[model samples]
Target chain A: MKPAIKRIIFIVILVGLWELGSRLGLWTELILPSPTSVFTALYHGFADKTLIWDLIASFRRLAIGLTLALIIGTSIGILIAKSKTADDTIGSMLLALQSVPSIVWLPLAIMWFGLNDKAVIFVVILGGTFVMALNIRTGIKNVSPLYIRAAQTMGSKGIDLFIRVIFPASIPYVVTGSRLAWAFAWRALMAGELLSTGPGLGYTLSYASDFGNMSLVIGVIIIIGIIGSIVDQLIFQRIEKSVANRWGL
Target chain B: MFISINQLNKQFLDKNDQPTTVLKDIELDIEKGEFVSILGPSGCGKSTLLSIVAGLTSATNGEILVEDKKITKPGKDRGMVFQEAALFPWINVIENVMFPLKKEMSKQEATAQAKKYLQMVQLSNYLEHYPHELSGGMQQRVSIARALAMDPEILLMDEPFGALDEQTRTRLHGQLEEIWIKTKKTVLFVTHSISESIKLSDRIIVMGTRPGTILTDIKVDIPRPRREHKEDMLELEEHVMSYLKKEIDKVVSEELNHETSH
Candidate 1:
């Protein structure tokens, strides 16, 4: 068998075994729900207005946080890239902070902003912005001197130079950074929802687990994974591949 | 008044707080509609000299005037073609050609102008092709077209065809000669290729390294659109080689010695 086919069949067999084992009474249906039961749970989630509200709440937080990160990070990146003083001051700090996980900020975030969605948004921004800044700065700095020289020769200077040459040339790297940031932010949001327990997918998971409805918990976990993957594959991955992979810049 | 470079000097600071001269007290005058080539070996600072003249870098001590205006900085009067094509990958061929003009003209005007220059380069069919999509020769043609579209007072090229294959380079030589005759633009082209210097340049400035300076300024009296490898071309090639071979050998052996010592 082809390697890809073999891998697919192996995964199918594993999932099938899990389903069959639960059905055969090796584990209770409450703890390890059948795939059918989880699919039903997913259906029930969409059948109400509550799930919509949860999604809106989560999305709104993600939107606000990510947007702020984009603006601030991009500005910081440009500064660091353009100035040696800025790099000396902030570059090391950024490196240190990026190494420190966003989850590590949760306790402090709770202390500062409380358990509201603001705290979650704050965490997301903290998770996302540094990655974007570092990548943008790196991309800008790595730009070929030849390109800049050519642009100068063509009478491109100042904003014209940046807009025409620097930004477009650095876009592929920016997209890569953004994809990485989105993953970090999304995972952070999920963890935030799980811990904070206000509303959203994470809340739903905790609520199901609290109620000892393990099947619903399993269902929520699958839903989160699917949503994350879909967003990555459909949106960020597509953009990254289009800009970075195809060009090989 | 097309271009004048007076007492051009450039210095670089070495690792030990010592200043090293790259180009020395050079004086050059380029009249309107002249084609000049600077010839030198790798470390001879010919590229540095060209870059300084083009206003890509500041001359440590000198003045460059394009059309009687002191060129302390880069301007539209000078259009430069890099050693690499250096076309922005995101933009298509036409867009790359149109870039210098887009800020001045309307989209329609820029498009027309871009199309005109692309046509000159025989790249009208590849207008929508991205930089990576085009062959190296095609990309360099686009680069030339991009510079030509600017309609600058002078064209500055830094070994622009160095990376190309010999056949493609020869083809480009012919195309470039045709374009030069058609446009009559002042050109200051830099190259290490002796045949290329003889073929393209009206005047050749041979340079020497180790505090780089002009060694000789030999005029090629050949007519435009001359055959590249004919007996006369070979004789001129020999003349250039006679000057450059010793310098090239010295630089190569010095480099090898340095590497071995390291």
Candidate 2:
């Protein structure tokens, strides 16, 4: 068999063992629901259609947060990289901001914006922007000085130089930063949902746990895992490999 | 005249904040279409001198004149070919060559001119190839072609073939000679290799390190298309090597004596 197929089979076997263990009463149903029971709950999740709405709402907010983070973060990153004064003053502030956990800001966001989309958006931006800016600054700063000199010799100056040279060179790092920020934002989203109690996967998971619906909680957990893996495998991982492998990053 | 460097000197403050001179009082005059090589050992400030001519680095003192005007910055008039063949990796061979032309020409015109220059280098077939895809020698050729495409009056080469293997270097030396003969641009080449300096230069400037100064400035007193393995070439090569050997020995012993005394 192919190695990839073998790996898949190995994972399936481990999951099968967990299911068997749960069914054989190694733990209570409350502790470890069987795979079949989880699947059943997931099916009921689809039947309700509220779960879909929750997913769409969360994904929409995520898109806004990520978009805002990209524009603001990259701009700041470029500024900090280009100017010594900017780097000294703002770069230190960015470093300090990055060290603070996103969860710590939830109450502040809620206080400022209330329990709506803005609060979640605020959390996502706070969680993501520091990583993006810091990585991008580092990336732009690391561009070979010789490369810049060569470009300058060719009469490339001002905006044209940045567009043709600096932007392309720094893209691999920006992509990497976005990928890292995605994982951070994902965690932040869950924490925010749990506390804020809106209609999202995290909120639904919390609601299920509050109601003692272990099966529903298990179903939400599976959904989150599947979606996270899909995003990593299909989106960010492909971008990283394309840059580092094919483009000689 | 093409360019003139009048008493050029470059200095930097050392760690102890003492002024340390790299090149000292360089005075050189180049007529139009002359090929001169600035030959030196490492740390002799040959590259720094070239950079000063190219206006990529400040001279720290004195003036460089291109066509009787002071060279305060890089312009289209003076093109440069670096040691590492600093081609833009993002652009293909043709685009790399056309980079300088973009400021003055339309995109289509720039591309046609780029192709023409590539053809001059016999690299028309490799127009689509990226810098990394080309061999080291080929990449350096692309750098030359890129500079040539600018239609500059002078070519400042800082050890352009210094990184290639023996066979590739020899072949490129011949090719460069042919190109220089055909184009007739004022050229200033920096090289550590004695034979390379002898082969390509109309005049050779041997610089000594540690507050670098011109040790010798000798005209080749030989014709172009000089071969490497010839008997006559070997005689002249030996003369240069022996001369450099004595100077190097003097330098080494002085440093050793200084060390022992300290």
Model number with the top TM-score? 2
Per-residue alpha-carbon lDDT of candidate 2 for residues A132-248, written as tens digits (9 for 90 to 100): 999999989887777777777777778988888888777788889999888778877877887886788889999999998898898898888888888988999998986775345
**Cα RMSD to the true fold for all candidates:** 2.3, 2.2
Q: Whole-model Cα lDDT per candidate?
A: 0.86, 0.85
RMSD of 2: 2.2
Model 2 lDDT, residue B222, Cα:
76
Which tens-of-lDDT digit does each residue in A143-246 have in candidate 1? Answer: 88888888888878899889889987888878888888888888888887888856787887888888887777887787778788888989988888777643
DockQ for every prediction shown: 0.70, 0.54
Off by over 4 Å in 2: A1-3, A246-249, B250-262
lDDT of 2 by residue, B129-221 (tens): 887788889999999999999898998899998889999998888888888888999999999998888878888888888778888777887
User: lDDT value for candidate 2?
Assistant: 0.85
Give the clashing residue pairs of candidate 2, or none.
Answer: none
What candidate 1 gets wrong by more than 4 Å, as runs, is A1-8, A48-53, A107-114, B259-262
